[model samples]
Target: MTPSIAGACGTRLIAQVLIAATVFSGTAARAQESVQTFPVAPSYPAAMPASPLGASVSALLDHARTTNPAFAAQRAETAAARERIESAGALPDPNFQVELMDFTNTMRGGGTTLLPGQVGETRYRIIQPLPGWGKRELQSRAAGAKADQAAAGLDAAWLDLATEIKNAWLRYYTADREAALARESLALLGGLEEAMLARYRQGLAPQQAVLRAQRELTSQRLAQVGIEQRRRGAAAALNGLLARAPDAPLATPADPAALPAALELPALVARARARNPALTADERGIEAARLERERTWADRYPDFSMGLTNNRPRGESQSWDLMFEVMIPLQQSARRAREREAEHMLAAADARRDATGSRLAGEIGAAYANFTSGQETQRLIRSTLLPQARATRDATRAAFETGRADFDAVLEAERQLVDTRMALLQAEVESRMALFELEKLVGDAL
Candidate 1:
């Protein structure tokens, strides 16, 4: 080969090597960058420091009231709504007028003895409109209804805020339990993998056993990944509900030892009907609409005014006259139509309120029933199924060590144990969530 060709070929080879190296370095860096940094899963906090149910409920409600923007906005709006009453009851301020007289001429030769006088009048007058046909009273009632609706609206806001907080708390509880279970499963799988590796190396186990163990370990690792993700998500949601940063640490009381015992459906329905804030708000809206229709009726009549006026001519004494002004508009087709529309709106609001109350009653009944059923299921699992599965696992392990139970039995037992544990955890989680939902639907007993 010529020296020049050789040099070119050498440079090409160097370029290829550089390109390959660059590609590999880029891939490695991307892989590292794609990896996530997860927060250390902190252990569950201690049980609630407070014991009185009322106090605990109040604390939670207070936290939500302050943290929830919806509730805060409603409070401010209700305070603003009070101004509407004062505004509605007030009459228009009286109008004032001022006038000045300039030059004036009196005809002297055009008449006989009577003076043919011209009055260049300057007059000052005040007009105050008197509300006719109980308009003021009707307006005051409407304003009062509006204020009532706003107050009820604030209650609804607080209710929703409280429900959101409770839901978030339950989610955090679920995350904690699931994460704990995942960690425990990981540890157990690790032990099994070690045992499988030892047996395989001793020639007592097939290579496939080691492979299977490795696969199981990897599966659990993946499960842990998902569990951690949920944990972080739950934490972030709770923090946001409490008006903190998504990553902010939270201190939550541990879940209760057991779910509440079942209650009669009738009682639950009653509670919901009495306390559901959304239902209350709807009722208030209906009342406000009714009052609005009444006020519209009063608007059909016009107001009246009475005033005194003074008239003076240039270089002459002032004369005063009392005047009364009455405004009677022609038949108001528009006002009548508006009154009918208000009536229909009031009817619609009333119907809507009734529908909401009915739905709330049904929901509370269903939630209570499901919650109790779940509680029973969890109790049964904890008392019987889980313990039996655990005993089976222990027995299988003992037999394997003694050379009686085969590898298949050991694996089967392990599977059953895992399934039982998972089922129990799910049951517990469901029961807890159901109870939380029930309480949210019906205000806390306390």
Candidate 2:
């Protein structure tokens, strides 16, 4: 071979080696990450060290992890699945038999006289059944995979519980903010009522203006009551999630959890694919189905049972007997049906796994989109809409005092300002809720 050609070949071989090394290392790292100690449970922070809202949420989640009945049920199921692995590969229980021969008076044993306790033979046998070769191992592997699936299910259950708690907390947060805003609006209306009354007494405003302000103040107070009622209901729901009495008091959440500084859609999708518990569970289900299918194929082979017997004849020498039993597996139709059933189940599991992946991807996308939109809306309302509304309210009030605008215009501007502020608050809460949902989907805190 030419030197140049040999050099090029050598370089190509080096590149191939490097590529293989990189792939191998990546695979090894991923495998390590996937290997977890058995009976894995969700981890919670030992202490709440963040904001008050975050701390409260963390504490509630910890409480629910141990106290919630639903979580307990899923945990029990996972434990059961784990235990099944031990029995999956076990041999059938050994059988013991005791037989007395010639016990009736009509028969006599060979070379023995027909006398009481001297003519009968008694046998003791023990038999053990062994499964076909490789069957037990396959059964064990299938059970292990099922246990993994159940563990994933338990993880998913925790995620669901966390999501519900977050959603409930957000709801309560929103309601509480709404009630506060309503009370603030009521106070503002009372001040406006006083100002209008003074203007009417000084002959600068009409009696109708004072009456309109009073009417609005009354309505605002009523709205405050309604908002408070909703807030209480939300609080009760949140308490229920925490496994507390409905009337239990909760510490006011001073602030909502902050959104991530940056969220990349592609990165989020990749994380979800890697960490989503639902998808992981489905993947394990596929593995279990495949293993079960292989086990069914292995079941086509015959199993064996062996028996050892010891017999003693009265006034005669002891004898030993050995026996072997084989299963015929003659029901070809039934075996074939089982194989077909396993094949279909594996196919179904694969389809379900694929469907779960697609659904998770869509959910991640939707949550990210909602989160981004909410952030943008909140920014717009805060930077432009709210300031503009406040400015309009102030300008209208000035115009009314200068006899250039009606009191109605001031009241309308105030209402617009109040509505804009509430919208901004709602947007903020919605954005935070979206983040919580995204975290749940990704199976990690963002």
Per-prediction RMSD in angstroms? 14.6, 22.0
Candidate achieving the largest lDDT = 2
Candidate 1, residues 15-47: lDDT per residue as tens digits? 343344334433432332232111111011124
lDDT of every predicted structure (CA atoms): 0.64, 0.75
Candidate 1 least-lDDT 10 residues: 36-45
| Candidate 1 TM-score, C-alpha based | 0.77
Candidate maximizing TM-score? 2
Q: Write the per-residue lDDT of candidate 2 for residues 154-215, one digit (tens) a residue.
A: 99888988888877876776777677667666666766676666555555566788888899
